[model samples]
Target chain A: MDISAFVLFWAAIFTSNILLTNFLGMCSYLSVSREVESSFGLGVAVVFVLTITAALNWLVYHYILVYFGIVYLQFIVFIIVIAAFVQLLELIIERYTPALYYTLGIFLPLITVNCAIFGVSLFLVIRNYNFLQSIAFGAGSGIGWLLAILMLAAIRRKLKEKMVPLGLQGVGISLIITGIMALAFVGFSGIVQIQ
Target chain B: MFTIIIKDVTVLSAIGSLLAIIMVIAQRRLSNYGDCKIDINGKRELVIKGGNSLLSSLSDKQIFLPSACGGRGSCAACKCKVISGGGPILPTEKPLLTKAELAAGDIRLACQVKVKSDIKIEIPAGIFNIRRFNATVTEIIDYTYDTKGITFKFADGEKIDFLAGQYVQLETKPYGKVKQGVIRAYSISSKPEINSSLQLIIRYVPEGICTTWVHQHLKLGDTVSLTGPYGDFFLRDTDADIIYVAGGSGKAPIKSMLEHLAVIGCKRKMTYFFGARTTKDLYLTDEMHAFEKVFPSFEYVPVLSHSEQGDGWTGKTGFVMPYFKDAIRDPKNTEAYLCGSPGMINAVTKALIEEGIPKDKIYYDSFG
Candidate 1:
């Protein structure tokens, strides 16, 4: 629980991946991974949102929930904070950066209920990570999620025309590929372990 | 225990309310596009407060665009060309547009296109004629076993100016488990000449959202919102003999046309082939018979598709297509206007084409 922020960052990306390892944000991961372009956009948005919300939620948890001994309310409070941040980020991105908004704006609303954001917050709370460590873990898990989705999207792009078994087409095939990838990431477990 | 429960509820609600307040403030401040100019077809201009979808914004300005799903991006019906300033199409709109449509550029679903910036858009010119009308349900009559005719009277002396065959999008409020209101297009059955009231023939389709709501939950004198006088299925002004074919509640618009023709005292030879299962499936038979007496050249033929032997059936038995040859004297110059289910429309259209009627001469509205 007292792991270095740098180690937690690396560990989150490889071993305790919010997506691949924990399987927390599977809905958007499966759905939006059909195209590399959209997957990249959503991945970047996730990386940005996860880092911000993790820090914000950590502050809210320590300063507010823990102060009241109502840490049990972390789930609802964390979801609310994530949703509120995503909403605010979407509005800012859309208004100022029109080009970035075109790519990332559409994905912001989808990311609100993406359990990965909530998952990272919960992971930080459960693991007792301070603000800096929480942010590192959030960013790393986001990048890990990004890497996983991008790889799947590339494979899916190639498999677009390639005939797979009828029963394992579309999402079925993607999930099977994800399982194999998760096994491959298991190879990185020796490099670092935080959970 | 009491204090802890109160504390838990209070904390959760406080956090929720705080976030809600922040979101509201952020939405207003960040999303305020400030008096955005909507250059519609480069012909008309409107300055309105921005931050709503293009469809709703236009509708707010009394310039109704055809959207069946209200502002939801699900229905791909509300499509317009954003010539400039409505940035790249969002992910929600991508699934609905076709590959060729995407390649052609600028064709965006109006419901998905948020008005965050001043944008010029091109819509069908016919869209201008459609208007949002406020009306109240005046009468609900059981026309048959499953079908009911609901007459909606225009509120506040306001009148609906629509063609006989054109239809309106009926808006239903959220009732029971239906969380949001649904928009359904039903043909205007009442005579357009009346203007003050419009009637729609709604058949109960079991679990159908709109029809079930209309049948069970809808009551007399209830207020309703309607967008209308839309569709290209109106009567064409030509000298060609008319062949009217319809079935089930499909008979609604055809009856409107017949009534309009009756009011105008149309002289062209007309024959109506109304198909049904049996006597129980039929409604407004007496009205059609009355039309036969009024018009000098009009003929009424009701074909019972599933008429049983010795069921007190005296009218034409069998499908409508078999009786088409006997109904008409001129096939080449006949303009057939059909309304019904897609199956019925396709079958009747094929039969008409085979009977020597030109393909372009046939008109129908297969409502989704």
Candidate 2:
């Protein structure tokens, strides 16, 4: 249970990666990963939302759910906390970061229901991660998802010019590419043992 | 066990309420964009609270922009020149703007642009004249099985000055199962001389919010709210030969133009072609015939595309394009006015272009 922050960070990205290994948040990973610019924007938004929601949910879980011994209600409680936190972050970003607001603004709403953020919070609670470990896990998982999507997007952009087969053009080819990337990511499994 | 359930409910509710209160406070503090000053054409300045869209802001100032989708950004009709301080064009606006317009850095969709700061925008001078009026439904005439010609008299003894072919937005109150009021643009079917009274011909669209309300729930002697005289679809002041093509409720603005011509006693040669699916689908035939009788220069031709033998229809049959191709003899000196669904208008516009009518000479209003 005494997981180091350094090991948790690397393990979340590589060994137990949120997208490539765990296969969570594949919907946006497949759809938004078609273009590099849009993929970049969505990746940054996911990372930002995931890290903050993870820390916020950790506090909520300990101070409220665990304090009252209502740990069974963590799922619904965590979701509500994540959604409200994302909304607040959106309003603040829209006010301050006008540049990033234009690029990543539209995808802010999409990040609320992103199962990857929920997965991070749930995993942090289940694994009994301390505050630092939870934050590291959250940021690492988000960066892992971002990296996977960016790689796939770059390959897809290249694949656009090359002639794909008749049957495997759009989503068919993209899914195949993702599968191959997932297999490649399995090579990083034993680098850092999370459990 | 029962006491444990109560405690669980109490704790969850407490957490939920705490989050809700926090959200309320954050929304109030963060979403407030403060009061913004909008410079209109370098002549007028409007200072208003600025958390909403530029379209709604302009509307609050009584400067109405023509938006068929009512600021939903689907219509793209509420576009204006954002001269400065409007910030970058949004992703919602990119698809609606042309490459040239985007590069020019002046045009933007008013509905998508938030007024977060002081901005300078240029709108058409005519938008200032649009005024909201309270009116009472004096009569509703069934023009077809699905269409009604509803006439509204100004609740105040005020006359509206408008062009021959323009539209007004009719605001519907919530009725029946519907809970929200909506505004729909309907063309004025009568000429400007009608003055204190305005008539709109509306076709019932299946399950449409405003149309269903108008057809099923609206009663005569009921008071309604309306805003005036929007659109560029109108008769040009020229002596050129006129060719008018219309179908269904598209006949509204065209009828207004023809009546205005008749009232002015203009002697230009005019050919009016009205298309319908069958004889039963046609209305105002007697009135059009009467206009032809009084104005020797005008001719009325009703075309039915789906007429049956029992109907005994003796008129040009098939789509209006063929009849238009045959009737348009002097395309060089002819101006064609078209109002219809997008399909019909596109066909007619194509035919007009093929027949040598200048693109600028072809005026049309196509309902999406």
TM-score of chain B of each: 0.85, 0.93
The complex in candidate 1 yields a DockQ of 0.45
Clashes of 1: 0
Among the numbered candidates, top DockQ falls to 2
Error of 2 at A121 (Å): 2.4
Model 1 sits at a Cα RMSD from the real structure of 5.0
Query: Candidate 2, residues B1-368: lDDT per residue as tens digits?
Result: 99999999999898889989999999899889889999999999999998788989988888888887888878898889999988877766888999999999789999888898899999888888888889999999999899999999997697788898899999989988899888799999999999898999999999999999999988899999888889999999998988999999988998898888878888888889999999998999999988887776888899998999988898889888877766676889999999999999898898889889999999998888
> What is the lDDT for A6 in model 2?
86
TM-score between model 1 and native? 0.79
Query: What clash pairs does model 2 have?
Result: none
Off by over 4 Å in 2: A1-7, A26-38, A57-81, A97-110, A128-131, A151-177, B1-22
Q: Which stretches of candidate 1 lie over 4 Å from their true place?
A: A1-18, A34-37, A53-84, A93-138, A154-173, A187-195, B1-25, B98-104, B122-129, B132-140, B173-181, B216-224, B265-269, B289-298, B314-332, B350-358
- For model 1, what is the error of residue B105's alpha carbon versus the real structure, in angstroms, after optimal superposition? 3.2
Model 2 chain A lowest lDDT segment of ten: A97-106
